[model samples]
Target: MTAEPRTHRTAPVVAGLLTALVGFTSSYAVVLAGLRAVGASPEQAASGLLVVCLTQALGMLWLTARHRLPLTLAWSTPGAALLAGTGMVDGGWPAAVGAFCLVGALILGTAAWPRLGALIAAIPVPIAQAMLAGVLVSLCLEPVRAFAAHPLLVGPVVLTWLVLLRLAPRWAVPAAFAVALVVLGASAARDGGVTGALLPQLAWTTPELTWASALGIALPLFVVTMASQNVPGVAVMASYGYRVPWRETMVVTGLGTAAGAPAGGHAINLAAITAALAASPDAHPDPRRRWVAAHTAGWAYLVLALLSAALTALVSSGPDGVVETVAGLALLATLGSSLAAAAGPADGRESAVVTFVVAASGVTFLGIGAAFWALAAGLAVRWALSFRRRGTPSADAASGGAERDAEPETDAAAVPDAEPEPQTSTR
Candidate 1:
């Protein structure tokens, strides 16, 4: 019998820090951009960052503890992208805040209503995985793209990651993070030493509700966050063989968003790529112990939230693509696994390919992102193929029918036919 492996104390700690680092460094700038797009001042944007991080951190802790799963909550990155694209709405930042609140309420409703939750859960495994792979493909390409763009900056980081992967696979991502920090620090030192107060700030803006804002911002924000962020997040967990509590997760994230909206924060939902980092086997060999990594990551996010002001400045001062490269490297393993899961099933191969292509293409239709359409296209293809196959008669069936019909003798003793055995399907 194989012996149980002893748990390593450092594994969970490293996973947690990596998760926190990836969460902040990878997308905080986009969040700041989104806030500004809606007319939030620099201080307001900083407060929004703090609020979103703190709120999501609490949600992560509560959800993971209650469910005993490695669930990570994050502000909706796609939703933020949507905001950045839309620019200032009719009623300005206050109106955007209102939209944020409305989106939270809608998300909460999905959790409260069984039918909605069931619909989300009922998404077929292959289709969900395909959608996730599509969502992640572009981001996953960034490491190599970053290296090609800035060899001097990203070369050492990528080399460090590769070296760690060969010698100590578990530490590969963390080593990359370290190398990035060193590179960024060196760059900053050459120009001037970084300076910022590591203090949390609170800037509250009362929401101003308007029908125009609701249609222009709230509805679209909710749609993108759910389709591009939350759904794929669920898919990520499922890809890793985790049965996430979808309804509870939605409700918790919705509540967190509602709590943060007044402070200029937008939507918070289940994380896709970063959550995979904490939940992966790399965090711990035993799946049961992986939750410790996510829980620790949640607490780490809280710590970062307290220092959001300084953290924001530090990230802003760092060179472009540094954070993206690190984030991409961190998720390389996840991207591989997700792609494998999405394409592994022969029956779903075409559908999954369609989903992956559309998602990675980043096309938008009628204000909706490509992710939702990719899922729809994949499901349609799956259904169409299944229908065609079921209707078409098999060669064995045709031959068996012809043979039986050709027999002249009707008596059972004259000639007996062997019945076909049942086939058991396997993945």
Candidate 2:
């Protein structure tokens, strides 16, 4: 009897550790990539990671404990990828930090205004999924490209990931991350003693707002976080039949983002993939007790934050391509799922494809990124098709009232979902 109680006590802690491991393995490299895109140095990037982890972890713990629901929040991995693809700006890191602050304020505004939340909810699922798939394309392809460039270094990482995916899917990413680190360390030791201290260092970057940075970096970051991360995150919770108070969650995440940005962090949002680990029945036999797992995971992230500088140092020691290779390996499963979601159904296929192509092109026009353009193009196509389906203006005018009735369900919260079976990996 005493043994049973001890097992019960230990389960949630174990679940939390698993959740944090998956969360870190899959997304930390992308976070580094994002900070680098804005010209953040290694110390600055480490600080960004530290602040983001601390803030999002606290937000997750607070929300879960308050609601008695496993509400897991995370940094927007897709938003980070968007920043990486956007490249450096005119005012550099300070300008990017300013953009980060603006994005947080925009998220906070959405929480305050029901109409704004409704508008965000009104974006069709296909376009949102397509945009996400598009954003992931470049990074997802890095493993293959990296192997081609550095077969000796990257091949082993990919091979280890593939083998573990077959034999021990849950350990696949963490194992690969470890293997890559070992190889990187060895390579560095061969060249010379690795430089850089492994202690956590906090750095702050003052915001330098610029018109070009705001329009280009800030706008795209906000859109991708909302469309790719937050929307899907809500969907994931709803899939498990959790009617999350999404607006409240948004308010807290926005506040977290605002707090972290000046410390070099980018936007934080809902966790779509890793959220399942704590929300699932697997976390605890009793559904009501699952929040304990999420809360524990939050504490674990806080612990991880203390080691952010060391983690960043390990990543910075490797060749850039090797780091990307590991990151791409970690994201493969997520990319596959996003693509599957994007391609679903017949009606939205055309719009989805257009969105994917434009976003994957990495094109920049008038200081704006392909992600914003892709979203615009997809929405335009969807609207035009809806108009065409309604026929001529007289017909459209005649059926305008009916057309309103024909609109796709815009209430994301109201969409019922069958419980999602837990995947082999949290991602």
The best candidate in terms of TM-score: 2
TM-scores for the candidates: 0.64, 0.87
lDDT (0-100) at residue 37 of candidate 1? 65
RMSD of each: 11.0, 5.1
Cα displacement (Å) at residue 113, model 2: 0.9
Quote the positional error of residue 351 for candidate 2 in Å: 2.9
| Cα lDDT tens digits for candidate 2, 1-427 | 3344666667777888899888887778888887887789999999999999999999988998899888888898878877776677768889989999999998887766645655665666667667767877888788888888889988788888889999998888778887888878877777674656688777988998787678778876876687667766777776777777766777899999988999988989888788889888778777788888889989999999988888788777777677777777776776787688777666547888998899889887876667778878998998887768667787567656653653444325212121122111111
> How far out, in Å, is residue 269 in model 2?
2.0
The clash numbers for all candidates, in the given order, read 0, 0
Tell me which residue pairs clash in candidate 1.
none
Q: Which residue ranges in model 1 land beyond 4 Å of their true spot?
A: 1-49, 60-103, 192-198, 202-250, 261-300, 395-427
* C-alpha-based local distance difference test score of model 1: 0.71
